[model samples]
Structures are given as structure tokens and as C-alpha cells.
Target: MAEVSAEARIEAPAEKVWAKLTDFSVYGEWNATHTSFPKGPPASLEVGGQFEENMKLMGFPAEVTWTVEDLADTRTLAIRGKGPMGVNVGTRYTLTADGDATTVRVDGEFTGAAVSLMAGKLKDSATAALNESLRKLAGLVT
Candidate 1:
């Protein structure tokens, strides 16, 4: 398995960060890996909700069918998905409010046979993507 994470301190409240984080309509605008939502974002963001996303990583395109694993308003969101070549993907977003600013962390995991072949490269690419995504997200909210 390959694991990656990135963190950023945004100059905005958790509520504002969470609003942009969960608002799937604008997800692709800041999410580096996101290409598009195949059927649009989930209608509602309850646990067990499902959505299809088209993504690109390391210059390769993939489609993932994701199931929401956890959710907490203005605090956390987690999802797991099945991706190309039997790879399993998991992502979690965490937010901690500190006065008027928010600290956001994104954690990711990749498993299955495919990951073993290029774990190092995947980790580098994913970590970079997460960092870039956070920067974009921060730009949007702050």
C-alpha cells in the first residue's frame, strides 16, 4: 500500500473551508486530481452516499466509483473507492479551526496489486497533487 498526506493552514474559518470542500459542484476547480464528475456530485453527502469521479493522476486517467465512509460537518470527510486495475483508493479530509483560520489535512491511501509496482512514484505524485490541491483550495477560500 502507498500512503500520502498534505496539510495547509488556510486564512479562513473552518465553516468556509468546509463549505468549499463539500461543495462538489466546484470540486474540480481546486482538486488537482479531479477531471470531472461522471454523474455529477452526490445529491446529498450522507454516509453511504456514492458518486462517480473521473480523475487523472501521473498523467493517467481513471474512473473511480466512490462510497462515502464518514462525514462530520466542518470537521471531516472520508471516502473510499474502487479504481482502475483493482486499486483501492481512500481519501480523508480533516479540518481544525483555530480562531479565524483553519488547518486542513488531506490523507490518502492506495492499495491492491497495482500499487506495489510503483509505490514510490505514486507517493511522490500523490503528495504533490495533494499539496497543489490545497494551495488551490486556499486560493479559492482565502
Candidate 2:
């Protein structure tokens, strides 16, 4: 398995950041891994709700079906997904409000027989993507 995380302190409130995060219609503009949502983003964000996402990871494109596993109004959201080649992926977005600013962290994991074969490279690539995503997100929300 490979794990990667990135954090950013944005000059925006949690509610504003949360809105941009869940606004999937514009996700591809900021999310580094995003390709498209073939079936569109979920109409609502709730535990057990599922969505499909086309993504490019480590330069390979894949379609993943993800289920919302956790939620907390403007604080946290976590999803678990199944991708091609038997890959299991998990992503968690945590937001901490500090006055008018919000600190957000994106943590992700990839696990599968295939992951073990290139864990180091995958980790490096994923880490880069996470940081880039955070930068873009901050730009949009803050």
C-alpha cells in the first residue's frame, strides 16, 4: 500500500472551503487526478452515497467507483473507492476552522497487489498530486 497526504491553510472559512471541495461540477479544474464524472457528481453528499470518477493516477487513466464513508458537515469527508486492476483507494479530507481560516488536509491511500510493485514511485507521484490539488483548491476558495 502507498499513502500520501498534503495540507494547506487557506484564508477562508470552513464553509467556503467545504463548498468548493464538494462542488464536483468544477472538480476537474482544481483536482489533479480528475478527468471527468461520466455519470455526474452526486446530487447530495451523504454516507453511503456513491459516485463514479474518471481519474489519472501515476500517468495511468482509470475509472473508479467511490462510496462516501464518512461525513461531518463542514469538517470532514472520507470516501473509499474501487479502481481498475483491483486497486482499493481511500481519501479523507479534514478541515479545521481557526477563526476565519481553515486548515485542510488531504490523506490518501492506495492498496492492491499492483501497488506493492511500485509503491515508492506511486507514493512520490501521489504526494505531488495532492500538493498540487491543495494549491489549486486554496486558489479557488481563498
Candidate 3:
């Protein structure tokens, strides 16, 4: 299994950051890993909602079918998905409001027979991607 996480403090209110985070229409503009959504983002975000996303991981293109596992308005959102090669992945986004600033953290996990073979490299790539995603999110929202 491989896991990765990253955090960033954006100089923007939680509401502002949350708006941009949940707005999938602009995700491609700020999310470095996002490629496209074949059927589009979920109409509503809630536990059990499903969405398909095209992603680029470690320079390799892949598609995932994701299901919302948890959510809390402006506070937390998590999704679990299955990708190619029997890989299972999960990502959790957490938002903590601090006065006018928001602390955003992303936690990711990969588990599957394939993960153990490239755990180190996958961790490095995923960590960088998470950090880059956060930086882009801050740039777009703040």
C-alpha cells in the first residue's frame, strides 16, 4: 500500500476555498491531477454519490470510478475509487477555518496488489501531486 498527504494554509476564508473546492467546473483550472469527467461531476455531493474522473498519476493516464464516502459542508470530503490494474485509492480533503484563513489538508491512500511493487515511487509522485494541487487551489481561490 502507498499513502500520501499534504497541507496548505490558504489566505482565504473557508467559505471561499470551499466554494472553489466543490465547484468541479473549475477543477481542471486548479487541480493538477484532474483530466476530465466523462459524465461530469456529481450533481450533488453526499455519501454514496458516484462520479467518474479521468486522472494523470505519475505521468500515466487512468480513469477511476469514485464514490463519495464522507462529506461535511466546507469541512470535509472523502472519496474512494477503483482504478486500472485492480488498484484501489481513496482521497480525503479536510478544511479547517482559522479566522480569515483556511487550512486545507489532503490525505490519500492506495491499496492493491500492485501498490506494494511501486509504493516508494508512487508515494513520491502522489505527494508532489497533492502539494501542487494545494498550491494551485490556493492560487485560484486566494
C-alpha TM-scores of all predictions: 0.99, 0.98, 0.98
Q: Candidate 1, after superposition: displacement of residue 136 in Å? A: 0.3
Number of the top TM-score candidate: 1
How well does model 2 score by local distance difference test? 0.94
Which tens-of-lDDT digit does each residue in 1-142 have in candidate 2?
A: 9999999999999999999999988898889999989998889999999999999988999999999999999999999999998999999999999999999999999999999999999999999999999999999987
Candidate 1, residues 37-57, lDDT tens digits: the string is 888788889899899999999
Q: Residue 85's C-alpha lDDT in candidate 3?
A: 96
lDDT scores of the candidates, listed in order = 0.97, 0.94, 0.94
lDDT of 3 by residue, 104-128 (tens): 9999999999999999999999999
Which sections of candidate 2 miss by over 4 Å? none
Best by lDDT: 1
- Backbone clash count for every predicted candidate, in the order shown: 0, 0, 0
lDDT of 3: 0.94
What's the alpha carbon RMSD for model 3?
0.7
Cα-based lDDT at residue 15, candidate 1:
100
Please list all clashing residue pairs in model 2, or write none if there are none.
none
